[model samples]
Structures are given as C-alpha cells and as structure tokens.
Target: MIYQKQECNGALYQMCLYSMGTMPGMSPRQRAGRRRTTEKAKQEINRRQRKWRLMQLINANFVSGRDLFVCLTYAPEASRARALEKFHAKMKKAYAKIGLTYKYIAVTEEHDMDGEPVRLHHHLILSGAHGVQLAEVVRDCWASGLADVRTLREGADFFEDTAIYLLKEDCHKGKGARRYSTSRNLTPPAEPVRLRLGEEEEAEVPPGVKIIEHVQNANEFGRYEVMVGRIYNQAAFSAWWAAQRRKAAPDPWERLRRRRQRKV
Candidate 1:
C-alpha cells in the first residue's frame, strides 16, 4: 500500500492505494516478477476507489464525460533523457492513434518503488465526442512500445470539489501532462443521507453516532439530522468505517521502515 500525503485541517493525512496485477499466462520468472507487480497495481486501484468515493461524498452530481485519467510509471532504467523523450513521443503517438483531444498529463519521478527504479509516469485527461475506450487505450500503448497504461475516469467536479482528499503533493507540484486540474464550484450545500439501505425498514444506530428512530428514509435526510440530530446505520457505518481502515493502513515497505525506526 502506497500512501500519498493529503492535507486536512492543516495536518497531513496518508491516502492509501491498491494496484492491479499482471494478466494471466506467464513463465515462472515472469510470474514471480508479475506477482509483485500485481500487488502494486491492486494497491493503486484501492487508492483510486477511495478517492472516487470521497468525490462522490462531496459532489453527488459530478459527471466525468469521457476524459481518461491516465497514470503511469516506468522502470528506472528508462529514466535517462533519451529514453524519457522516446517514452514521451510514444505516448503522444499512442494518443494520436486513439484520437484523444481532451487533455494529456504525465509525471516522471525518481522514487524508491519496491526497491526498483520507478519513474512515475503521467496523468492524462482526454475528451472526445465518441469517448475513449480504456482497454483499447492500454492496448495501443503496449503496441506503441509505451508502458502499460492504467487510466480511470476522473470527474472534474469530483477531483476539484474533493480537493481535501487529494495528496498535498499532487495539488500544486509534479507535472507531466495536465490540461485542467481544477473544477468549477458546484458542490451542493448539504449532503444527502441514505437513511434506509434497501428494504431494511428498521433503523440502525452507528457506533459512536446517534440515530433518530423517526427519520424513516432518505426522503427526510436533512430533516432528521437537524430535528433529531445525526443518524447512522450500524451496518452501513461499520462497512464504511472498515473500508476506511483498509485505506488508512500502511504498505508493507512502510511497515518495515517503521520497525527499523523503532529499533534505532
């Protein structure tokens, strides 16, 4: 789990991530190497999911057209100036092939990634009437000799309004390919609460929070929180809180670092 630094109330909070693994069918050596790769990918996926959830919480009506949020990282051996230029060129060619006219963002940084030379790639924001296909975009990159592309739909309103959830490092610093990193202010004044999840009619009280028995359903979201105070469903709250825990946990490497620090 890689944790990004986010700012909250003038304090830094760590943002967790889950990465996706490599595709199936490979030799033993390839399998071993890819297992580690898959773990990293899984961590990234988890991170993005959390970010998406945070965005949904803050901005409910946000729509992310067809723009692609492309994030990539490369092996350290390819970090040289010439290799970097080639990689950049490859990315441009791939985008052109895919007919991406929206936005392209990239970032190449030297970081200690699993003891390997890691070059943080870029983040792309693309827009087109036909919309882009995620799988096809990745295929094109591999075909064009660029690193495998991992992109997602990053809503403008989602990323901007939920700025509080973003890593402080990603806010003003680190740039490769970016067109519009901010979104217009459109967050609603209040958040809608899901009083009743599905067919469960019985109200549940979240641990550490109170539930007003009379609030029945979402139709009275704001009414209850105000009249009867904040209501929390025990099950829903527990699940969400558990998810938060997984996100907040440190990666294996970070754990080792902590252990070393304690020993010293």
Candidate 2:
C-alpha cells in the first residue's frame, strides 16, 4: 500500500529516477553548517550542479542521432570573450542560412584537450534538423580555429558522462569564470507523478511502452524503484491497442459473416 513519487525526463528513451527513504532534501541546519566548506569543496559542488542542469536540458530536448556535440577551438587570444563574441555572429548566421533553429550549452574552456589552461575554446550541444550539414557549416563560420562535430552518444549513462566530459575545464577556471552557458530553448523535464503502487501492479506493462531501464533498492525506510521507458509513437501504439482489444473482446459480427460465406 506504500506509494512513492516517480520522475521522468521526456527523452526518446526516457530517464525515470526515484529514491525511497531519502528526505526531500537537506535540512536548514545542514545548510547553515556548510560555512566551513573549503574552496575546493565549493568548486566540486558547482561542477556537479552544472553537469546535472546541463543533463536535464539535454535529455529533454536533444536526441542522439539528430543533434550534435561540437567543439570550437581557437588560436591563442588576448581576449577570450571577444573571440567568442565574434564567432557567435558568424555561427548564428550560418545556422540560420541552413534553416536551423539551434539550442546550445556553451562551456568555455582553458585546457588543450590535455592539460591546464593552455588554449581557449568552447564546447556546445547543438540541435540539428532536416539532416543539416552540421560540421561543414560550423567549420565555415569559425575561421580562427577548428570545428569538430560529433553525434551525441547513446548508452546507459544517458549523456551524464557526456556532460561531465564537456565541462572538463571546471578544474582549470580562473577565479570567478562561469562554468557553462545554455540557450533559452532547451526543455526541462516534466514534473513527477506520484502513484501508490505495489509489486503485483508493478508487473504490468502498458501496451506500447517499452521499458528501457529499471532499478530497485530497499532499506528500512522501504523499497525504492526507478523505471526508464520509451513511449512509442501514436500509430504503433494504437495498432497494438486495437489488436489487444479485439483479442480481449472479439466481434460477434465476424462469426456471422463467416457463416454467411459458408452458406454461399
């Protein structure tokens, strides 16, 4: 009879996560005690928060094959901000010319794909449409440096690792530099739906929903479960549903029609 809350990010292969026995969040007292948190601890917290927020935007809006992860690298620059500003002007025009409306999370970087803060660059996750020429367009727009475009990878991590890798320059930031920037268009995950569910009920799967991942954990507080699933398109779902309904409640008219055929 115990009920728990379930959360789903509206991705193609959905991300469903929930935990039981955990308090909603840290208490006020816990927050006040954090005054002693070291600078290193604060940076780690910032990095994790940055990654989590980016992942939400990614899972909700971007898909693996349809979107891209792009890297824009530049020669040594006196002003990193100015270099990025100039690049954005051309990049936006290029995307518009190709009939694309893009959403991006831009992470400013200082690493040389290897060590601490040698080069200046930006990493982006861009929305692609209509089989657009992603790499060519970006390469054309960014003359100062390289534009490497890659398809977003798909796996059990669900782009969590991707976010972390793209934000890898966190440890190399100078003083108060930003961790990342996101375009306004990316979607946030849907609000959670709470259900009172039990073992017998959990065994049932909906007609057209495919469960991709499910995990269950237990403790003195109770059993916690997470389920990730994909909702098939309407046509496929409706066809499956109609077949199930026909089997559950057969049409008597079919029998009569068969009898008439036999008489003929």
Candidate 3:
C-alpha cells in the first residue's frame, strides 16, 4: 500500500510539472501548445500590426483604381470564366462574413501536372482587415467548415508558413525540405502586403457586387512576378507623389505674408 501511495504522489507531481510546461518529457509541440495565453495574445497582436503595415504599403503604392488585388489559378482544362464565377461566389460569402472589400486578380494559367486539371486557385488584393495573416483567414474558413481542410496545402507550418503563402523562399529552402518544392530551382515570388484600413473603420464595399473573395495564398502561375513588379512600380509612383507634396512648400506669397505678419 505504501509503495502504491508513493507512485501516486510521483505521478501527481509529474502531471503538475507537465501542466506548468516544466516536465522534461514534454514534446516541442506540447510545449508550444502550453504557452501562456497572454504571451500568445501579445504575439498575435504584434503579428497583426506587421501584416497591417504590409497591407498599407501595398495599397498606398500599387492599388490605384482598385483597392484590392485578387489572383486566381484556373485548371488548364477548365472553363476559366466558370471557375472565376464559382470562386467569386465563395469570396462573396467570405467577405460578407468578415466585412471587408478587395479587388480580384484573374489567373492566367494553371500550376499542376495531373488530370485534376479541373482544379482552380486564386490570389486577391484588397483594402480591408488590418493585421491578420492571410493563412489565418484561410484557415478560419476551413475551421468554420465552409471549406475542406484537404484543399489546403499539406505539411504547412501554420506559424512559419507565411513565406509559402506569400510565395517567398521558405525559411528552410535549400535545406532538407527541398522535397517541399513544387518545381525545380525556381524561387517563388514574394507577396508582400500593405493595409490601409484602421481599426475603427469598417470596409465599404459597393452594393450590387455579385461576389467577394480573399486571396489567401500566392499565385502559383507565372503572374506572381508580374503582380509584385506592379506593386513596386506603384511604390515608386507613390514615392514620387510624396516627394512632390513635400517639395510644393507653402505658397511663396503665403510665406512672405507670414513673414510680414510675424514682423508686425
């Protein structure tokens, strides 16, 4: 009886340590899951801020007539228009639920080699929802049971997987994870974001719009390069505008008037 009692106490102690994340046998996954809620909240808040800034930069620079960019990938054999229409329906619901507005980028090609040539994908740029990773938004859709989890790319690390969704070099690129690549020696385009919406502001999507969609992932076709380049060009244009704004100082007459007033 004493031996059993001692074993019970030992087990209880180990369990307490486990709950506190101090146990030696805990796996990394377990430890990560056990992180303090406050810490996780802080990290989430900061991540939102970073993502929001990206959105703002993109919007201020690249998006001129339209505020959002949406990219879609249509299967080689599929009807591109129909695929876009279906995707548009999905996107409409998504935006209504989240309450945001974005512009769509039509896909110019497919990105696979199988008879699943009927499959479709999309990329989008929009002006709404500051400070959330596009992947999180996509995952939320899956979690809501609106979409199937299988549709999402597998083995994607939810935390460090932004580069993949953003189409940038994977942190482990050229490492053992080389098998994760979809093609050979081709680095994906980097999808940077810029957010312009403020926390207190709600997105204003014009009425009579038939659909709204979020580009949760990067373009897999040849257009990623084109879109990023467009954004850079927009950034350059914005920089020029800002420079002109700065250079156009107070009217010379106004300055002279102010000087006289100061002297008087």
Question: Candidates' TM-scores?
Answer: 0.29, 0.54, 0.23
Poorest 10 consecutive residues of model 3 by lDDT?
A: 1-10
Query: Residue 137's C-alpha lDDT in candidate 1?
Result: 49
Kindly list the per-residue Cα lDDT of model 3 for residues 166-224, writing each as its tens digit.
33322223434321211121222223222222222332222222112211111211010
| Model 1 regions more than 4 Å off | 1-65, 82-85, 94-102, 109-121, 128-131, 138-151, 154-157, 161-167, 170-264
Clash pairs detected, candidate 2: none
Best by TM-score: 2
**Would you list the rank order by TM-score, best first?**
2, 1, 3
Positional deviation of residue 233's Cα in model 2 after best superposition, in angstroms: 14
Regions of candidate 3 where Cα sits further than 4 Å from its true position: 1-58, 61-81, 111-121, 126-128, 131-264
Answer with 1 or 2, whichever has the higher lDDT. 2
Residue 58 of model 1, lDDT score: 34
Residue 98 shift from truth in candidate 2, angstroms: 2.7
Q: After superposition, how far is residue 250 of candidate 3 from its true place, in Å?
A: 26
lDDT of 3 at 226: 10
**What's the distance in Å from true for residue 27, model 1?**
77
Candidate 1 lDDT, tens digit per residue, 56-163?
433333235544444444454544445444544565566677574323323334334233444444433333233455545444443323444443444443354323
lDDT top scorer: 2
- Model 3, position 225, has a per-residue lDDT of 6
